[model samples]
Target: MFENLSERLERSFKILKGQGSITELNVAETLKDVRRALLDADVNYNVAKRFTDDVKKKAIGRNVLTAVKPNELMVKIVRDELAELMGGTAAEFKIDGNPAVILMSGLQGSGKTTFSAKLANLLKSKNGKKPMMVACDVYRPAAIEQLKVLANQLGVPVYSEEGSKDPVSIAKHAINEAKNQGCDVVIVDTAGRLAIDEEMMTEIAAIKKAINPTETLFVVDSMTGQDAVNTAKEFNERLDFDGVVLTKLDGDTRGGAALSIRKVVDKPIKFVGTGEKVDALDLFHPDRMADRILGMGDIISLVERAQQQYDEEEAKKLEAKIAKNQFDFNDFLSQIQQVKRMGNLKDLVSMIPGVGKMVKDMDISDDAFKGIEAIIYSMTPEERKHPSLLDGRRRKRLAMGSGTSIQEVNRLITQFDQIRKVMKQLQGGKAAKMAKMASRLRRR
Candidate 1:
């Protein structure tokens, strides 16, 4: 997402490398490089200047710990500043309203409608709330349909009056519908409009007034860089949004918007859309994001993702199975499914410390597990349950069925045996717990 910025920041930090402490000369040169990196990342000129200046003021003459290197100390300083620059901590919103209204505002193509559905799904599945999506984008018929499709997929209700041109009226009726349906959360997906369009802005402003949303979020495209920041400012000046929702952060974005929007609009980034999938939404965490930008990785977020898919009872079952050497193809397939549910494979890999830099250039696809899944699926149910029953003849038949070579089938079986051995050895240790977590994030 911030690949270029991350690399540049890494290079900037290297200026302190081999130094015993943070001195004026070394810190100045490093700050210069850091400033240039921020500029190249499309950060606002004033924001970049203030950030580097603030960083310099805090960095130079700092008492470095005996065990910490100059570069490490500098990294800690910059990471803390970066976190503070982006909202010091995660912001909280009122989701407890009898029917909480969340108004979505942004320009077309910023993925606002899509994010609304994503947020609805997140609230529905994770927060135990009945979220009903209200399509108030009256100008765009397709937008309504899109929300409906996503709502249907999520099994959430959608309130829309087809062919109605009055969005404010639709919004009011939607709230009433929410009350009638006993829905606790009503996310109103408003029409996307330009910041310069006074009429459009006025329309949305009226809708916001009518609904009195508990949280009015301005959805922005992170790839738009400084433009996103400016648009956010314009919207905030008009509607005074409660927070920001950054969409398409998983794309090839320079990350200027994320770093600058909060400073410019004085609002917290509440959520971020990582991928196109409804499940790809994440609560924005500034410290974790700063860690990711500095190439240090976000192990906490990694563990959290793994934890979401980690089943205590299932893990216990597998632990018992591994202890008894009863791990089989069926267990392997189930583990693969858990990892797949964790979201993008490359994004998942990037969360591991040190692994992100190594595989930054590797084209790790979400389909990385397809071959392995196919091979397992080709196996007979009995063979999956009792993998030991797979003789040479069975392996050959399975390879043909899976459109793979016999060598691949043999290799998979060998790898599975090795994993069983490793799991057995790591049992009853902290390494085993981490191994189980990593295993849950593995693609295949």
Candidate 2:
């Protein structure tokens, strides 16, 4: 998402590339470029200045190690400062109450309603909490219905007083409903305006006062750039929210909001909406984010996501089948679906170390696996179970059924054979060691 900024930062670091040591002249030259990069990324001017100042104060007088290059040392200094500029660490999302009330605030079309459901899904699935959603956006037509639909998908309860315009009263009743339903978390989704207005601010403030929530989150569209930071400042002045939530972070945003919001409002970013899926939410991690911005990748987050989709029992069965050389199209398709469940394909790929920059210019679509899936779906049950049964004639028929050329079908069969061979090799030695580590992560 911060493609432009990443590129600019990379070029700026090149100014120190062959320098034998860190000097005031070289550091100043590199930081001038860094400051320009931050400004181009829409970062706040004062923040950019202070960030560069901090980096210089820590960098200029530092001794460059024999093994570490000047550029490498500079990168470490900048990465640490970037993390500090964000939030320094992950913020705790407190659900500590009889029924923890979380008041959601933001502008309309900021994906507030959608994120409400995402949060409910996360709490129910990960935190083992029964979350009840309260739709208090009575002024917006069908806002309550939208919350109901999202809550219904998660099998969570929804409290909404139809025909009631008083959001504060509705929120108060929703907490009671949550208590009766044995829900441990209550997320009240309030209405938003097209822009900052007195009536909108007053209504949400009253709702917050009535609910006395455990956590008040101000949601903002990250793609709005500087405007997102400005809106957060205004909201923080009124509600004094516990944290901020940046939505639409998966879009082509310059990432200014995420970099500047904390400095502006003095609040931790509790969460970020990565995609439109109900499970596309991620707890904000400033250090990992700083790594990604510097093109170092985020292996920890990638492993965590992989761990989420790992099933011990299923892995045992799959390992057994692979050992027996019985891995087929069905198993292949299952693997594809598991990867899909992890999140966006490109985002997942970008989490690996040093790979993000390589594929930054590639248009890796979520539908990259569509053709293979179609071809496999066209296969007969017997063909899927045993790849040996797929003769030339059968492949031609499958190609015709899947609207693909015969050559494409043949290529998939060859690729499947190669994958089986690789699995066989992974059953021993160094590969087996890696597999053991992965197993431990799954169990963790």
Candidate 3:
């Protein structure tokens, strides 16, 4: 996400690499480079200056222990300072009311509507809450329809009053509807203008007054750089928003808004939009983000995603099948599906330490398993259950059905067989313990 900033920060740490201990002169040199990196990332002049100053002070104050290298100590100091700058810990949304009302505020095209749907989907799936999206963007009927379509896809109800010009009324009515429907959360998607104006502020203020929302989130596009921070300040002045939502973090953002917004508006970033998908919303964590900026992969978030998608009962059943030598094409297909459920493939793979930097330039599509899934889907029920029964003739038939060649099918079968062997070794206990140890290291 902040690949450029990460590269710059890593180079800044190299100033202390050959030094045996940290001195004021060396720390100043390193902090100067770090300051430049933050500026290059579009961080505010004052914020970046204070950040590096704090980092320098921390580095100089630490004892020069024998076990820690000077460079390692400096990196630690920088990481802590960065975390503190971004808000030391994660701040969750207040969804405690009977029908918790979350009002989305931002300029047009800042992804307010999309984020509303994503938040609803997240609460429904993760928090086990029945959320109803309220479409109050009456100026654009298409926007309301978009919210409705997204809500339908998520299997969540959407409340909207067509042809209603009064957004406040629509919001109030939607909240009542949510209460009637037994919804635990109501996400109101309000209308936004191209820029901040009195009218826009007035409309939002009225909606807030009418609803007395439990949470008001100001959504800003991270790609706007310094403008995002400025807009956030303007919004907070009028709305006094509960938290910030930085959208389009998946884009080539220069890390400006993320680094400066919290400092500028004095509000914690509650959520980040990593992608356009409804499942792309992530809770903001300052420490984890600092690790990402320092080119250290966020393995904790990766494992949490895995745990969310990993079905323990299903895994135990698959282990039993592997031990019985009954793991077949169907089981392999199921495993692929489970991995896909963990979110984007490239995002997941990049969380592994060293893997992200190694393959940063490679094209890892979200559908990395398209070919494998197609091949598996082409197989009949009997073929999926009994992969050993497939001969040369059967392989050719399967290849043609899946729009692939015989060699491709053969390669998949070979990989699946190897996976099954690994599963068997894991079930035998020796390999499983080693795998667990490796996972723990990656998480660190």
Write one digit per residue (lDDT tens) for candidate 2, span 341-362.
8999999999998999998889
The lDDT values for all models are 0.90, 0.92, 0.88
Can you write out model 3's per-residue Cα lDDT over 283-380, one digit (the tens) per residue?
Answer: 99999998888877899999788767655567657667877989898878877887877887777777887777877788989878898988889888
Output the lDDT of residue 245, model 3: 96
TM-score of each: 0.96, 0.97, 0.96
Q: How much does each candidate deviate from the true structure in C-alpha RMSD? A: 3.0, 1.2, 2.5
Query: lDDT, candidate 2, residue 46?
Result: 91
Model 3, TM vs. native: 0.96
Candidate 2 clashing pairs, residues 3+ apart or interchain: none
Report the C-alpha lDDT of model 1 over 280-370, residue by residue, as the tens digit: 9999999999999998888888787877787767877888888788988889999999999999999999998888888889999998888
Question: Relative to the unseen true structure, what is the C-alpha lDDT of residue 236 in candidate 2, on a scale of 0 to 100?
Answer: 93
Q: Which stretches of candidate 3 lie over 4 Å from their true place?
A: 430-444
